[model samples]
Target: MTAKVTLSFTDETIEDARRYAERDGMSLSAWIDQAAREKALRELFNAHADVVRRAGHDRLEKHALDDAREVEMVRSEFRGRRAAQR
Candidate 1:
């Protein structure tokens, strides 16, 4: 069972939402629902990341170094893309 809800937005926001809805081939309500779900998932991931960072890692020297190197490579690639755009 579902209950109906009313939402209000500024004209510009409504236009943007309509555009996004058309792009996704969904009704504005469906598009908003999908966007909300994605946002919730991202927030959950961010919360998990904080917990993982606090715990720290216990690992062998070689394995730890390899993991760090992989992370560095990804960071550098992301930075390079950002730098190119600027």
Candidate 2:
């Protein structure tokens, strides 16, 4: 469901926005809607950017630990092989 919104803008601004809307092959209302949606998304992302960063950091740390464990396991296997060949 969508509600109609009425906004007032300077004539010059409205003209510029109309031109942009035509250039993008969209209606003026659609252009404004997209702009507002994008602005809202940006604000939401900014608000949780730190939380996102921390989640990413935690994932990288887990991957690093898992990789280290795998490498050590391979090294141990090779050491055992060398011992058997001795």
Candidate 3:
């Protein structure tokens, strides 16, 4: 079930969205709906992630700062390896 809502956009933003819709071979309304849905989904996921992190903070044993740095180092190393292989 869907309810219709009216939204107002600045002229420039509207024009940009219309151009993007044309480029993607979609109607302006369809493109806007798709973008809106994706943004809403992302926000919902982020909210859920925050809630989960808060709930498990004490149960999680790893140090947050060290874990983040390690993850970044691993990601950088992996990227370098991949680039070298490529």
Candidate 4:
């Protein structure tokens, strides 16, 4: 289902969009619709990520952090061993 809505744009912008639509072989409405849908989906995913980040750190987050710490420790140990061998 779809509905038609009127929108206003500057003459220059309208011309630009019209040319873009033509180059892509689509109607102006279709071009705008695709752009709007892509932007909407991106915003929706970012919002979901924000909610997850705010929901409180849990076991999964802690485990990832712990893994990173272990990796750093191993790298530091290797550096120390290399320095000793030099």
Q: Write the per-residue lDDT of candidate 3 for residues 1-86, one digit (tens) a residue.
A: 45688999999999999999888777787678767765775686567557758888744534543477756865675455435433
Which scores better on TM-score, 2 or 4?
4
lDDT of 3 at 82: 39
lDDT, candidate 2, residue 30? 69
TM-score of 1: 0.61
**lDDT of every predicted structure (CA atoms):** 0.66, 0.68, 0.69, 0.68
User: Against the hidden true structure, what lDDT does model 3 obtain?
Assistant: 0.69
Best by lDDT: 3
Q: Report the C-alpha lDDT of model 4 over 1-86, residue by residue, as the tens digit.
A: 67889999999988998998788777788777766765775686467556656886554555644577755765675555435433
Off by over 4 Å in 1: 58-86
Give the runs in model 4 whose Cα sits over 4 Å from its true position. Answer: 56-86
Give lDDT tens digits, candidate 1, residues 1-86. 34579989899998999998887667777667666655775686567566656667433434644677756765675555435433
lDDT score for residue 41 of model 4: 56
**Any residue pairs clashing in model 4, and if so which?**
none
Best by TM-score: 1
Query: Which residue pairs does candidate 3 place in steric collision?
Result: none
Q: What's the lDDT for residue 33 in model 4? A: 72
Question: What's the CA error at residue 10 for candidate 2, in Å?
Answer: 1.5
Sorted on TM-score, highest at the top, how do the candidates line up?
1, 3, 4, 2
